[model samples]
Target: MRTVFKNFLVLAVMLGTFTSFANEMLEVTPTFNYVTKGNHISVSDAFGEVIYSGEINYSGNLTTLFDFTQLKNGKYDVEVTNGFRIDISTIEVKNNIVFVTDANRKTIFKPVVRNENNSVLISKLALDGEKMDVELFYEGELIYTETIDGEDVLNRVYKLDKTLKGSYTTVIKSNDRVFVKNFRI
Candidate 1:
């Protein structure tokens, strides 16, 4: 029995290490269409609105099915939309990209990390004639910054602490137009 127990423990540890090693980073298209027409458009695309996971009765982050299991450490095609929020570290490699969402947040963002620090710092640039106030959220904490001109778009910076599993969301507002983008794990 003692030998069996020791073997089981060894197997568990070995399996864990193997899984970790096999784990790869996912480069996702955080946004399919940033500014399609109106509010919730990008959000719909990001979460697959009423398409896969069920449109009417099920309002779940439809893209939840497309969980990040699609890519390895290579370059994966990503789509940057109006409200691009992706916390790149916590990706679940399924058949597709299922964002690893915050337990408390209805929304999720997979922010990409440049270094081992796992700190995802994003840069924002606007387009031709759009005025937007981009707001960033990390694990329920709100950090906001505004951008007036699309050409003169400013950058907003925020960090996700370790204890909180680096989930993010973006809110872009222009007068009566508002776009909300979130991640789903």
Candidate 2:
């Protein structure tokens, strides 16, 4: 009986992984971003092969790698293109600025809100390339995790609950050097 239960559990887990992503690594082709009208959200290519789809902070000027000025707010679909499987594990918003990081892909993303002009800016960093295909899904369809931090720089993914927060982790490389921002706060 225990053996049977174990097999079922393992099968279930495999199915879950398959259904969640079509490929192993997050992938996107001809990257794109968008924003909705009423809600004021924007999604764009922030991190490596990742999308920054959410609200648009137009109170001030914003900057993103791709063309997000035409971005709108709505149910943004962050798809992993090029057969790369990517899942946004965590996202945090502060002072109208959205800070998102997919440690699952070893990347950090920051999307600032620009409500007045109805737009948003995207910034990010990604290292390590597992060379896996990627996919995308609707919200609440993926699972993320929260992690604890230490005294020094915290490495690894985590989750933040009960605060309109999203958290998770991903695999990355160490030898690769990609600088998103080098400013001191």
Candidate 3:
């Protein structure tokens, strides 16, 4: 009985290893598109400079592929935005070949930041329970900063000081993505 149990355990381990390898081999090449209007795709280098930009003019289900083989070997980001959530795929190019993994892909829910009268309203649909950091800057100085966590939906209202009339900047960060919005008081 002891020998039989050991044989069964070895077979189980081998099957598990094969399944993991199969999943990795089945990963598809990343494609950029969405079923809507204003679909924009941009590929940026490691230094945050856009190298290639394209737009899908028509509406509905469509896809546009970016040739990664044309780029030099380095790390890059492929971003697709459609006035809503942003999908970011981080790829590494080596020897003129692009390598992508599922672990480096993420989707960021864009927060709605707008000024209503003297108050700034910020709202986001964080269904994935992603943490967010919000910072308020006045005249290029950090005034207020907060870390939001453990919520499916994030909402906040900040009443700007009317007396200090200057430029205001709101920065929201989530899942390694930073969004900045500038306004005047």
Task: Write the residue-wise lDDT of candidate 1 on 36-100 in tens digits.
Answer: 32223212223323221211232233344334454443223232222444212222334544444
Ranking by lDDT: 3, 1, 2
Superposition-based RMSD of candidate 1 using all C-alpha atoms, in angstroms: 18.2
- RMSD each, Å: 18.2, 22.5, 10.8
lDDT winner between candidates 1 and 2: 1
lDDT of 3 by residue, 46-146 (tens): 99999988885666433334557778989888787868688888878899776774577777789999987888899988878988999999999999999
Worst lDDT 10-window in candidate 1: 50-59
Off by over 4 Å in 1: 1-125, 148-157
For this target, which candidate reaches the highest TM-score against the unseen true structure? 3
lDDT of each: 0.44, 0.32, 0.81
Superior by lDDT: candidate 2 or candidate 3: 3
The alpha-carbon deviation from the true structure for residue 125 of candidate 1, after best TM-score superposition, in angstroms, is 5.1
Number of residue pairs clashing in candidate 1, backbone atoms closer than 3 angstroms, sequence gap of 3 or more or interchain: 28
TM-score of each: 0.28, 0.17, 0.60
Point out where model 3 deviates above 4 Å: 1-37, 43-51, 60-78, 88-106
